[model samples]
Target chain A: MASETKLSHTTALILHALDAGLVYGFSVMEMTGLPSGTVYPALRRLERDELICSQWERQSIADAEQRPARKYYKLTVAGRATLEASRRRYPLLERLIPTVEAKQV
Target chain B: MTARVDMVVRAFQRGFLSCISLLVPSGQRAEWRREWQAELWHVRRACAPAGAVSWQAEREVTAFCLGAFQDALCLRLHAPKNEPRIALLHGSALQCLLFLGGVLAASYGLTLLLPGVRVESHPERYQVRSGLIMIQDEAYSNDWVAATIPVERFRDWETTRQRYFDGLAFYRIGEQAVSAGSHGTGGWEVAEASKNLFSLLGLPVRFASQEGEADAGLPQAILSDAVWKREFGGDPRVVGSVLRVGGRDVRIAGVAAEGGWRLPGKADVWLLERDSEIAAGGRGHVVAHLTNQGRSEMWASYVHIDAYSPDEPGDNLCGFSFEERTRGPWGIYQFTVLLAFLALPAITTVSMGEYSVSSHRPSWSRRLCRWGYMGAKIALLLPIVYFLSLDVAYWHTTLYSLASEYAQLAASFSICLFGLRWALLDQRQRCPVCLRHVTNPARVGLASRTFLAWNGTELMCTAGHTLLHVPGLPTSWFSTQRWLYLDTSWEFLFTGSGVG
Candidate 1:
């Protein structure tokens, strides 16, 4: 039930981007070519659905970078399960990105 | 160069985001605006080169704006209010019901405040703008002067149907001025009316009987006995003498009837415009008889006629049958249209949303009172429109018409200024929470109510912090009905039915 897979291509792309360590909203946009308006609200809905969780990056890190602090998203356990199912269902998602060992936030 | 381009991009982004937010829901609109603009900045920064906009940059900007429209559309679709539900239906239904009740209550309220106003007394006679001659009686007059009869239209419509319709061409009472005396150039108001005005309004013009004193198509003014004395000190030489008025020198045609003809606007010192015929083929104000068989009404009306409450008899009703005067929907619709069109929906929304007191006074009490003031004046001045338009002798008899309306208008002007707060003012309850006087408390609907007393009053503090201090109930619906012991009257008691 937690991994109940109803993943669309757009959702799979977003999940794959999160797994690839492109966690920030702008970073996700860079990875998936999705607009910020779409990506931000989707992030909110995903968080609401408990498939993704987010936290603001450290202010000091942003100060050093001379930019606003970015909010970061990481897949929850349920989200990971869903992603696993989505990867199988949408095999091209994996082929489109570099393979990397996913780390838990 | 890069900085300049960045500045330009940021400015354009700011303008676009501001426009997009107009469609966003009120609750999340600000937050979404800031978030999207920030994201847009990032997209543009990433896509733009150091000095100029690239094709990729423009595409990114376009995509971002398009996405913004999508998000705004979603937000606007259903930003449901978080409110309570009870006996009747859901929260949305309750809100709609409350809104409708407020409007109805306001309409009912208007009757209470403005009792005794009659609709028929309002002069409603105006002509269509089909090449009619226009006369500026004055900005304050706002009266329809006359319509011109183009030769072509006259030949086509009137001359063709001359046997059936006796309606004449070029009806107008052009406003002209006269000297109060040589006391340092004082101006007196007068009308330069067409001769047809005299016949239409049942007025008679007295031409100078002396030989050669009549107008030979020159500017000719006639002094009434009143103006004859006041301006010329009753000098008989004033007759047929030159009286300079409206920057033109004109001979006094004759002294009008003692008090001046009973005309609308009580125009004395009239000049038969030598150019009155010029309006025949020229632009003219469209005017009909001020008193028609069915009576008359003024269109483009901000002036409300005196209305007696349905609870009372309106003797001044301009002869409308009682049913027409008191019909509910038409009157309210008229007011609703009036409020919506003039104030651009704010007044309508305010009137509909604010309904704290209903029973004895109903919510629209103050508006009714203001309408009463205006309507009473209209009733009082009912004869003015007819007399003036027809250049009749009635203005002499109703000498106080203009002054009476002016007095009422002054009162209404003050009332209109106060109507803003009075729209929200509920007479039954007083606001004591803020101790900020009677004006500080607002009526916030109860979160939940049963069918019982419907909507009761709550005194709320509105200065920064919200503190609802509710007074005890005066009465409930149960006070009236003899319920069978098992009747579902408890919904009236336990749940909020009328707490809007």
Candidate 2:
């Protein structure tokens, strides 16, 4: 089922953003330059399909930063494989989102 | 000022998210709201920054909140194929109440369409319209007795009525041997009335659709509802037929509606004669329509008219009373329903068994949902009972009379009592925590050994929220059923049970 599942360009951008360590929804929205309307549903579809997983961050970490705990998202093993296949299909998916090391810089 | 603006923006975003949460499946709604709220906090920090507001950034945050709708819609659409059905025929309180409401609306719609049901349901139309008065002599204190005025005096009043009354109508009641075509002759009470009486009183006499068909030479006759049923067998063709009354042939003009026009005493027929000798010398009853000025002076029991004089001085006093209207069937229904509710405790056990101490009291919103479910069921059931009783009472007969009135009262009272009992019983079977009807009742202990074991049936909430224990036999210690709330530790037993 995963092999035949085709990803739209918007979905590919969100997957690439997640793979690039843009783990939070706002960060993925910022990196992809996509409006929240396009980004959130794509993330949900990917998560429901088991291509991505999410969890709430520890409260202590958020307390130290003096903010509410954020829900974090990351590519699963299946998600990474799907993103590799999507890159071949979309061609310029790599250029749309920077790698984790590039994002840190 | 900027801080206040930020507060407003944040509130708007949160409110939008809360609305979107409703579209998500109930099991996932809380988690979905938590994720959106957390993201909203981060989005605002990045967009507006502290102590400063950017309209562009605020717009972006607004756009982010709007996105939650698509996500919630996606989740709701893709909700598990075998997701637990919210409405189990046994348990969903909301579904049950909504079903009752639908039935009520459908019944009311039917009442509007069916003529018999329509007449019984709306009593105001058959009642006497406002401002009708029965004029009587001062000596006639008893309203039951018909008071008469000399035809000359009535004609004088009709011609010279300058105040208090718009119009005056006269009718003299007398028994006449009446015979219809092939129907046996009977002595029927007949009213010899002026031709303009019905028009003056504004009473609608239902005539056959084909007008001007009756014999022009003969006088006209309007049949009372009882005479129409008894003599003519309620055939509409009876109109335009000839009837022999007091040895004179009269053409049937129309029929009076049931429960209509009870003034000037009861009569089976009204003879509308264009020119009658009664006006020359005979005495008859008088009914008058009050003018607006007459209405203003209605507080007093009698009106002193300059036109009226007596044979002896100080004996000219005359009085008027508003026409008495029949008690509406709807009033009887309301009275019986009230009596039924008051008698409910005497017939059935009214207490819903106490919740166990181990179970936490439901939160305020949960309590509201539970009680609101009961209130909605009763609200819908009442109209259903009312319309159904009207249907039962008037199903075969088109007439609204004493018999149908009694039928409606009995039907409404019985249905209301049983319907209310069922509502309370159904509410008792529901799980307070989830407001769903508890299911899977299994008898756990022996009925004969009630002293040692907790002898009763055990019912479980389908959602794993609680278990209900109903005693098969009552004891001093365990007289009523109780509910035990199940904690998360007991949830494993309900896994793969189609509960979300």
The candidate that wins on DockQ is 2
Model 1: how far residue A10 lies from native, Å: 1.5
State in Å the error of residue B416, model 2.
1.1
Which stretch of 10 consecutive residues in model 2 chain A shows the poorest summed lDDT? A96-105
What would the TM-score be for candidate 1 when compared with the true structure?
0.40
Error of 1 at A39 (Å): 3.4
Cα displacement (Å) at residue B349, model 2: 3.6
Q: What's the CA error at residue B276 for candidate 1, in Å?
A: 27
Clash number for every model?
54, 1
Docking category of candidate 1:
acceptable
Looking at candidate 2, what is the lDDT of residue B24? Answer: 93
In angstroms, how far off is B238's CA in candidate 2?
Answer: 19
Q: What are the per-candidate TM-scores when only chain A is compared?
A: 0.85, 0.90
TM-score of each: 0.40, 0.59
Candidate 1 C-alpha lDDT tens digits along B1-500? 36576567668767878898888877778766766665666667677746466656776776776777766766676555544324223323223335445544554444334312221122221112221112222332334222333323322333343321244333334455555445235556555545444333333345563542445645656666666666677766656666667777767766664532322344556655533333344333322232232133433322232323334443221111212222222242344333433553344233322222323222356456534433443332222222222222222232323343333333333333234324333321222211121223444444355343344333332221122234233234322211011123333452343432
Among the numbered candidates, top lDDT falls to 2
